[model samples]
Structures are given as C-alpha cells and as structure tokens.
Target: MTTDPQVVALPMGDLTFPADGAIFPGQTVVVVAYAVRHAGGVFLFDTGFREAAPGDDPELREYFQKYALRTRSLPDVLAAAGVDLGEITAVANCHLHFDHSGQNALFPGVPIYVQPAELAAVREPDYTLPEVYDFEGARFEQVAGDHEVAPGIRIFATPGHSPGHQSLVVETPDGPVLLAGQAVYTRGEWAGIPGALVGSSDTRPGADQAGYARSVARLKALNPRRVLFGHDRQGWPD
Candidate 1:
C-alpha cells in the first residue's frame, strides 16, 4: 500500500522589508518552508534565507544588507519537525530567489529540483544569490515541466513571480495540499477576494502580470483542500 506522506510547515523566521514601492514596504512577513516525509525520504520545498557572515562576497553582503533578512536556524527548524539534516533526500525550490533558495548549499550531493528557466534566471545579474546554490557538491536537476517528485508529490510550472516558478501539490491523506510559493501572497489573493492587497506576483517586482493570473487560475482549478503560502503564516481553508 502506498501511504500518503506527512507534510509539516517549517517556520523559517521573518523578513522585514524596507520601503521599496512593493506591497510589503516596511512590513514584516513570515518565511516558511515545507517538509514532505515519505517512505522514500524527506523532500524539502523552499530553503529559507541565508544568514549574513563575515568575509562573504561583497555582492552577497550587499544583498543581505539590502533586505536586512533574518532567518531561523535550519537545523533547529528541521529538528523541531523530527527531521535531521542528513535525512533530507531531495530539494525542490519554487524559484531561486534569495529568500527561497538560500540554504540550498546545506544539502550537498542531494538532487535539487528546479525549473530550467528559473535556473537560467538566477544566473542573471541581481537575480539571486548565486553563491547560495552554486556550491561544492550542489546537484541541480532541472525539471522543465510537471514532474512527479515523489509518490503523491507533484510539482508543476506556475511561472509568474519568476520565469520558472512552480507550485507543489502534495496528496496528503486528508486531501490535496497546495504549496503556493509566492504565486499568490495570501489566501485573500488566492480566493480572488476583491481589494485583497498587492503582494503577489501580479504586483511584485519582476513579475509577469498575465502569467501570474493564469497560474493562479490553474491552481484554483486544482481545488486543493488546503492552500499554503511562502510568506503567510496562515493556511487556507481556515
């Protein structure tokens, strides 16, 4: 029998944005990641922010200084969920933004799944922190389209926020759970509630407004039992 995997939300701490004309100027939002524990192994989605350190690349230092990013201990967060660092078998990033793929280097020799376009975009100037993912032992498996990452776990392209952004669908015992990473800012945005606020791809920097709309519509068609956000601490179906 193929039993459903258990999904746990990993609290990655908070990010307080400075006024930059985006939806979250001067606002602090939660940084979250998810761990899917299956018979095969633990698959991680979105690896929080990279902590600032001395002697870091000048660009990296500047990036951290720019956002004033704060992050929780990855090991501690995983430990709280009964997971160990070495036990992580795979990684999948919704996109390669600094906040989403910062800790990817931690999982060396592990297959990190990502969209081809996302990978290419990350290489561009001011796209993301390259040092974060381009480290020794880093193994990237570019997934161009919908792929079965593991049993009952599927990742499909949901590009908008980034050229290759994707969302995850986990078939939990309760029902399908959608991990909408920055595809939509919050449940209000996903629900299409009028006057919902502007923090999603439609309003975020470097976003494709039309693509984002289509992506959100596609996600709605899935009819997930619960919807989760990368920045929102709350889950849908509340």
Candidate 2:
C-alpha cells in the first residue's frame, strides 16, 4: 500500500482588531502554517512567528502584540504532525515577512524558495528592516515566475502582498488547492469585495495591482476546489 502526499495545516496564532475590511474579526484572525509531504520529504510552506523579543519597529511590535503572533517553533509543529525536522527537504515562503520567515533558521541545509524581487526589496536600505527578510542560514532559490517544486505542487508568482509575493497551488485529491498566501485576505474579501489585497505598501516598493488582478483571475480560472487565505477563513465552492 502506498500513501499519497499530505498537506497539513498547523495552527499557529491569531490576529485581533484587524484593520477595517481585513479578513478576520477583531478576535478571529487565525494564522496557520502548512506542511506538505512528498516522496522526497516534507516541505513546509511558511514558518509561523517566533517566540523571540520584539524588534525596533513600534508599529510592527504593536502589530505583533495585537495579533498575538507568539507560537511554537516550526520544529515543534512538525513533531506534533509526526514529522521530523531532518526529514524536511525544503522551505518555501510566499514572502519574507517576519511572521512567515521566523523559523527559517531551524532548517539550515534546506533550500528556501523565494521571489527574486522580494529578496531585492528586502535588501534596499529603505526596506532594511530585519523583519523583511530572515536569511540567517538559508539556501535560497530565487524565482522570477512560476515553477514546480514538487511532484504535484506548483508555485505561481502573485506579487501583490509584496513585491515578489507568490502563491502555491497543489493538485489535491479533490482538485487544485490554492494556498493564497496574502494575495487575497479571505474568501469574503476575494468574493465579497472588489480589489481586496493584503499588502499595499508605499514605503519599499509597490506591487503591480494590475498584475495582481490578472493573477487572481487566473487562479479563479483554475477553479481550485479550496482556496486557503493567509490569515482568514478558507473558501469552498458551493
């Protein structure tokens, strides 16, 4: 008997008092980390927040506190899922935000896939904030566009949340499951409202809102059975 690759969603933390029109309620924002199992080994989607001290940015610090970003390490979460850290083949991040890249250091030898533009944005002096990119001991694979990292997993460049932000599409038993990292905050945001995007910063650099629109359209066309948002409720077709 053989077992198919598994995609597991691990609970991390929650965000309260989200900005108006944000995905979650003042007390219902849940952050989840995902792990994918393939023949090669387990691949983690994003590493949740770390249990470290707050950084220098007041707004970020406040945001961390307001959202309750504290959570167990990636290794612990994997252990709970009956997975071993040593078995992890690679780490993939939609973008390099602190909450998403905190535990990247844990997987020292594993290759981390990130968008080239996203990496470049974090390197700029204006974006020199540490939270932008956590590259302590990571092996990076800078991607420009779409690429397949595993057997049935494909990543598409969805640069809206960040300059090089991307999303993962998995060919599941039911159909394609879009791990919509922060492209669209929630099912409600995507379906209910028009032009709802998570990251729209004017500081570092701006994303192609038009490109984002097209990407969303493309994902919609793919007709995924399930769409998992970054910090809100998942979407399922009726």
Candidate 3:
C-alpha cells in the first residue's frame, strides 16, 4: 500500500447527446473510466454505460437511443486494460449517473464507494438507473466527503453536476493524477476557456453552479501533474 498507484484510462464508448444534453446539440462524446493499480490492488473510478436492452424503461431506452449510447462489456474492457475483475479491490464512482455507474452491478461484494447524497439522489424517481447501483449483491460504502479509499488513492467531493459527485486523486510517482468525473466536461473548461462545454452544471436542471465553480477552483488549486476527465478523451497538458 505504500507504493503509488498507476492510473490508466479505459475507453468505454461514445455517445451523441441531444440538443438538451451536456455538450452542444448533436455533439458526440467519448465516455471513459480509470483503473488505478497500486500495491494493495486495483481501484476503479466510474463504470461506464451499459448496453441498452429491450427491458429497460421505455423512457430510459428512448433516452439512450436518442443519445446514441454505445458501450462495451465492462469485463472485456477491464481485461483489455490488463486488469482482471478479481483483482479489483474496490470501486468508487464519481457519481451515480447512467453513464457513470451502469456496470456497477458487475462487481458484486466489492466495496463500491459513493457519497451519501448521491445515493439519495438515485431515489428521485428518474434520477438514474436504480438497478445499476442497488441490485442484489451490490455493496455500497457511503462516504460523506473526502476520504482515502486505498493507499495513495483518495476521492474528494466535487459536487455540482450531481449532489454527491466526487473526483479521484491518485498520488503517483510522477505527480498527482486527477480522475475528474464530469467535474469539468473537457480540457477547455479546465483551462477556463470561454464558450467551452461546462458539462451538466450549466445545463442540468437544478444544477448548483456556485458549488460547481467552487469545486473546480479547488481542483485547480491542487495543480495535478495530469488531469483526466470523465467524458474528454484527451488529458490536460497534451
């Protein structure tokens, strides 16, 4: 647990948002997840979207189709990333959105860390796919705020897009690597570029723009060696 963790980005899939979505109308976004390998074991940040099915709620199914949601099997994605499901010691989702926690049910009994408020959000009727997070065998460890989940890996509350959204910080040998889960949609937002997509804070209903701005400022203060985003394929400093 003393050794710093190695962080790797795993490509989940691509989806196109509608006019009312996070990005610009009809913009396509690439989903991503992170795998952190440390001395203790592998820790995952955010499980990507699941394959759409006929049994899904009609409204949700239509929503997925509207967004052009596409995703690969979580196990396959992890295997291709050189990580086995059994090696995953713990899981922490940046938030409980459909695209962030869709595959959480795949890792039964693994301590999935989440914020208490996020769990609370899932109960608001159509917040997210409830089965994706609360299915049988799903083990959730509700951490209220900033907490270290594993050696060298910690999650800090970055709420804004969602009431309990959090971001992961890994102390790697090179420097701190931040796995920003939709905190800022793209690198442009990270750089404070005008007109850049601001993810859901400026768009989603009931969004707390002030809290989001504060969270972003806090992340900028950290001055991480690398900043990886949930939806952006490109990392900062490229």
What TM-score does structure 2 among the candidates reach?
0.80
The 0-to-1 C-alpha lDDT of every candidate, in the order given, reads 0.84, 0.71, 0.85
Q: What order do you get sorting by TM-score, best first?
A: 3, 1, 2
> For model 2, how does the per-residue alpha-carbon lDDT over 1-238 read when each residue is reduced to its tens digit?
4355677776666545555524333545566778888777787888876664554467656656666554776677788988888988887887777667767777766889988998987776544356534646668888788989988887888876577888898887778888887776666666765644343321224546676676777778888888877666455442
Residue-wise lDDT of candidate 1 within 1-238, one digit each (tens)? 6657888899898877777835567777788999988889999999998788786798888767767787888888999989998889999988888788888879888999989999888877767767876778999998897899998999978988899999999988778999998887877777777865445534545678888888888988988999998887888876
Better of 2 and 3 by lDDT: 3
Better of 1 and 2 by lDDT: 1
Give lDDT for model 1: 0.84
lDDT per residue for candidate 3 within 41-83, as digits (tens), equals 9999989988776677787778778878888888899999999
Error of model 2, residue 217, in angstroms: 1.0
Each candidate's number of clashing pairs is: 0, 1, 0
TM-score of each: 0.93, 0.80, 0.93
